[model samples]
Target: MLKIRLKRAGQKKKPFYKIVLMKSLSKREGKHIIEFGYYNPLKKFAYINKLLVYKYLNHGCYPTNTVRHLLYRLTQNKINVK
Candidate 1:
């Protein structure tokens, strides 16, 4: 099953995350099918590709709990699209 989840990145104290698409059973830091967004909790920053997200969602990609919340938060915060 494909899933949308966060992949840990960045430094020790200063954490960063990549919002990626991958298999549900895959390793957290393993190869991702696609990386379409990112989040930095410390910075209260998020960047999600709405088009891709919706596309994947329609195609049956489920977001993890954290990713779900972040998606909600993205609507409340200022998102930076690239």
Candidate 2:
């Protein structure tokens, strides 16, 4: 099954993440099918491709809870994610 989730990136103390499309059983950091966005906790930053997200969602790809929450936060923050 395909899934939309976050992939860890960035530095030690300053954490970053990439929102990716991948297989459900794959390793957390395993190969991803698409990298559509990024998040930076320390900077309170997030940028995502909403169109791609919806595309995958329609194709039966589920987003992890954290990623789901991130989408909510994106909307709340009014960051023009689309």
Candidate 3:
């Protein structure tokens, strides 16, 4: 199972995260299949690769709760409902 989750980085007290694609059994901060985006909690910033995200999601890659919420906001106005 592949997952979209945060990889911890940055210095102490100033947290930054890499939104990555990796296997479920792999170490949390270890190897990643791909890096699709970035999030800086302290700065309240997010940057994502929509095409990559869509491709992964279609392949059954599930994002962490925080990433899911961010994706929801980013795609809200652009997504169409039938």
Best-matching candidate per lDDT: 1
The sequence of per-residue lDDT tens digits that candidate 1 reaches over residues 26-59 is: 9999999999899999989999997898788877
Residue ranges of candidate 3 with Cα displaced over 4 Å:
77-82
C-alpha displacement of 18 in model 2, angstroms? 0.4
TM per candidate: 0.88, 0.86, 0.87
lDDT of 2 by residue, 1-82 (tens): 8888888887788789999999999988899999989998888889999988878787778888888889888766422222
Model 1, runs deviating above 4 Å: 76-82
RMSD of each: 5.5, 4.6, 3.2
Question: Lowest-scoring 10 consecutive residues by lDDT in candidate 1?
Answer: 73-82
Order of quality (lDDT): 1, 2, 3
Candidate 3 residue-wise lDDT at 41: 84
For residues 10-44, write the lDDT of model 3, one tens digit per residue. 99899899999988888878999899989998878
Model 3: what TM-score?
Answer: 0.87
For candidate 2, what is the TM-score? Answer: 0.86
Give the poorly placed runs of model 2, Cα more than 4 Å off. 76-82
Candidate 1: residue 44 lDDT (0-100):
91
